[model samples]
Target: MTRLNSAATAETQQSWASVLRITEVAAGLPSSEARRPATPAVVTLQMVLEKLQAGWRWVERKRSQQISAKRLRVAETISLGEKRTLSIVTVDGSQYLIGSSAGGVQLLTKLDDATPNNSRDERSQ
Candidate 1:
């Protein structure tokens, strides 16, 4: 009976000592450090807007380059009067003379490697 009493008393004292040590450690820390809450990193609105603008500019530049690098381009257009027009279109390095009027569009001719100084009379056709 006496041995049991002593063992119970020792267990209670050991538990109280552990509690006191924990309290002392907690007290040693700064109040701010102990109470600070965990939070995600903050991002400013200006920073986000700047990033968005940079991305938009990049997209616009790429779109412009793609448009300018297309395989087909109209080199020149001449109005023949009375709603008629002739257009020189370049496709994959080849040039074509197209005639358009109120009737419809027609492929006038496929121009050879002729310089721009040379002229052709469409009236003959």
Candidate 2:
């Protein structure tokens, strides 16, 4: 066999790290526009861990090829220390939290999207 290139070795290492990273999971209702808090919201680190795990599990299920398992969207995204989120409540009320806590909106995507609260109308789909 040919010798492995440095880039290839590095890429292989990266993949393992991603696959082995612990996923945290948490629960927190979105800060509704109607219920925007005058003060900051405080959630425990434990809660954050839960949400992160859930988000990672969500991605794993999606990326997996198994047919005997399924994971539904539960929350849009859970928040990290920064603005990054680990979970999220998708339109239709199902959350679609993400595992990678690196960037993007922490708790929402679009305010206009209609959810289960609506009739799946133009409000959000």
Candidate 3:
């Protein structure tokens, strides 16, 4: 508290000095001074949130568009079960097999499905 009071007193005394000509002070002013406005603290927070939300929406739209491109780059295998099934794949590299055995080739379609790709053969149905 004492330290703050001493600093305040020093600052008060220092303000008495006109350290420069008015013209010199005007010339030294930063260019941004002309753009300054008396914005309330809540107004500043609102402006920041608006900018953040706009950027978030732009990112979401861009990310959704990239899904198909990323899907094209992936080449994964699908499996069918034990009776030795055979299938045909589409022109777009999608697999389709028609076979039904108790333990044979299993058809895998989505990437998020954690099916076994190691023991599968690649002849589309």
Measured by TM-score, the strongest candidate is: 1
Runs of candidate 1 with Cα error greater than 4 angstroms are: 1-42, 117-125
Model 2: residues with Cα > 4 Å off, grouped in runs = 1-43, 65-125
Local error of candidate 1 at residue 21 (angstroms):
58
- TM-score, each model? 0.52, 0.22, 0.31
By TM-score, the candidates rank as 1, 3, 2
lDDT of each: 0.74, 0.50, 0.49
Per residue, candidate 3 scores C-alpha lDDT tens digits across 1-125 of: 99999999678545422222332454355879746663686456555555655565576588678865453322423354444444443325544433445665455443332234633543332
Q: What does each candidate score in C-alpha RMSD?
A: 30.3, 24.3, 22.3
Superior candidate under lDDT, 2 versus 3: 2
Q: What is the full ranking by lDDT, best candidate first?
A: 1, 2, 3
Judge candidate 1 at residue 75 and give its lDDT. Answer: 93
| lDDT tens readout by residue for model 1, 1-125 | 99999999789657655655554554465888767653343125334444555565676699789998999998999999999999999999999999999999999999987665553544344
Sequence-dependent TM-score of model 3: 0.31
